[model samples]
Target: MKNVYITRVSKFLPNKPVANDTMEDRLGEINGKTSKGRRIVLRQNKIKTRYYAIDEEGNITHNNAQLTKEAVEGLCDESFSKHDIELLSCGTGSPDQILPSHAAMVHGFLQNGNVEINSPSGACCSGMNALKYAYMAVKSNQVNNAVCTGSERASSWMQSSIFEDEVQHLKTIEENPILAFNKDFLRWMLSDGAGAFLLENEPKGTTPLKIEWMEGYSYAHEIEACMYAGGDKLENGFLKPWSEYNSDQWSKQSLFAIKQDVKLLGKNILSKGVESLKNALEKHNLNAQDIDYYLPHISSYYFKENLYDEMKDNDIEIPWDNWFMNLSEVGNVGAGSIYLMLEELVNSGQLKKGDKILLSVPESARFSYAIALLTVH
Candidate 1:
């Protein structure tokens, strides 16, 4: 099999950095509650900080396209010219335009007519999906060089009025009443950001990190597990005051809403992720002990806690300290989380050449995906 390696990785964050406490305070204000004397705590019991783009007026920017452009430029740098890029893929849930794809927009900004752009949207799994696709494309000799970028701007949807409306809507539902209980939790978990990565068939430097192998599996059983639908509601025999087109619902309902269902889904997803890792290791004639790092999607505190316990039960040794928990800082940037984590690891010197990295990502529909045996060298 051919080898595909990550040539360069770059990230662009907002100029203004908000600590967890600051974010908590902002949330408290939005909820009409006093934040004085309150201790803001993250699920991992770690300090979380995130960067948000700010305009000249010092307001947090919610422009996904601008952030993406910055990140891509940072990734390409002087080593790679626009003409050198053969293919480009953007893995994101957020896009600036409704008609043109985010990938195409990126291609246009890069102004490289030599590149073919494709966009893949897989919710939080989008980044890994793009990497997997790029790997396959290179291994198949379809593209000698490729780039996959994942970026998001989640602040656009974090509106108090909209959230209250969602809560009211959920309260009206009979079958899934428990979802209404974690309004605060849901609000706290979602955040904004963007990241990019440059991949190639040949290593540009002497450093030995290489894409060993990648496998993908998607489970469509619970397609609507996480959904966002917008529509006008009739209240008191009259439509609401909001504009007709603006009256839409953005929601996230998952099996994790219920304790029993959470455990089941957590167990199943973790087991599948482990199985995928084992399969990759077996194919490469490697073992769990051979892996040096594990990069799992920063889904939620609950999911991460359960996944850790499951790994311990299965006799899997996880480097919990180095697991790359960026969600606390960046919130959840959908598919960009994993790639951002990778960039973080590299920048922090936690990841080195010849180290094997295992990646696991779970989607909303009980779709647990995992990739194993990616060697840094």
Candidate 2:
């Protein structure tokens, strides 16, 4: 197999960075009342600033496809252009529409000539899966180069107007669900952004990141969904998808809104994740000390200490200095989280030849995870 190197990394974050106190203004109050859990969520997540694709009036300024298109365009220059790309792969948790694939919409905005396109669907791992697809395409000589992207327009889903009907439905039953619930918790936790990576058989810079190996796993068979949208988690642990519910039920239940089972998340998010990492490390005969940089796509800072403890117990602890994170500033951009982290590090001018970077992303959607090892060449 041919070696694949990341030629470039680019990111696009829409509009201005919204501070913590101003989040309520951008997202608005659900049912015209303040969110009781917003402060708690922000405090635990430790997110100081986040971007949104909407204006103060809660009107959309950029959609998912547009954000991703701009990020891909940023990858172009005299050496490379959209027309030169042979494959396009895009991944996102939130898409502009349901009919067309996310990659199709991005391709429409790019108009970069006819090329093979792939869209990986799901939560965080979706983006890594897209990268793997591009990696394999170039590694197998199926394509000379590919553009892979991960992005989110979560502000579109966080709007208060989307939950009006569901709020009323809760009031009827005399139930008050706070923002930490399955309905509104993510509003303060997600930011708007897109990130792209250009992968080719040839290295681009003085120290280009090479794709050494990648490993992904899912524990869905042993666990229920931890985070989800376009569906409701039934008591028996079945996810009733959007198609199962009619139009009337959609608005009443907020079926399209993102939600997470907080209890399940707190329990399994870190434990299972570290287990998978240990397994991957064993398979590759690599140790934590071998890493020069550690990039993990954790949803919040709440897991930082716990993850460190878990890694230490599993004998997979990388030193604190080797870790890099931008979660507090960028928020959790779903599939784009790791891409954004890599983009910043790739441009930080800190990397040198022979450095090793470990990339890990654990999706709480259903306890799935992916880990990759990259080497600077």
lDDT top scorer: 2
lDDT of 2 by residue, 1-377 (tens): 89999989999999888999999998888877888888988999998998999887777899999999999999999878899999999988888888699999999999988999999999899899999999999999999999999999988888888888877877887777443366778877999999999999998765578999999999999999989999999999999999988889998888888998999999999999999999999999998999999999998899999999999998999999999999989989999999999999989999998999999999999999999999999
Q: Considering summed lDDT, which 10 consecutive residues are worst modelled in model 1?
A: 252-261
Candidate 1 per-residue lDDT, tens place, 1-377, comes to 56788878888776666676566434333334433322432544343666545443446565776777778778654667667778888877656656688887777777767677778774667777777777778888998878787787655444343354444566676543332323343344555677777777777653435887676666555322322212222333232222244324323222112111233344466666665555556676766566677788855654677677766666565767646667666666667777788888777765666777777666543454746456776
Q: Which candidate comes out best when scored by TM-score?
A: 2
In the order shown, what is each candidate's alpha-carbon RMSD? Answer: 6.5, 1.3
Alpha-carbon TM-score of each model against the true structure:
0.77, 0.98
Off by over 4 Å in 2: 175-180
Deviation in Å, model 2, residue 335 alpha carbon = 0.3
Task: Predict model 1's lDDT versus the native.
Answer: 0.61
Q: List the residue pairs that clash in candidate 2.
A: none
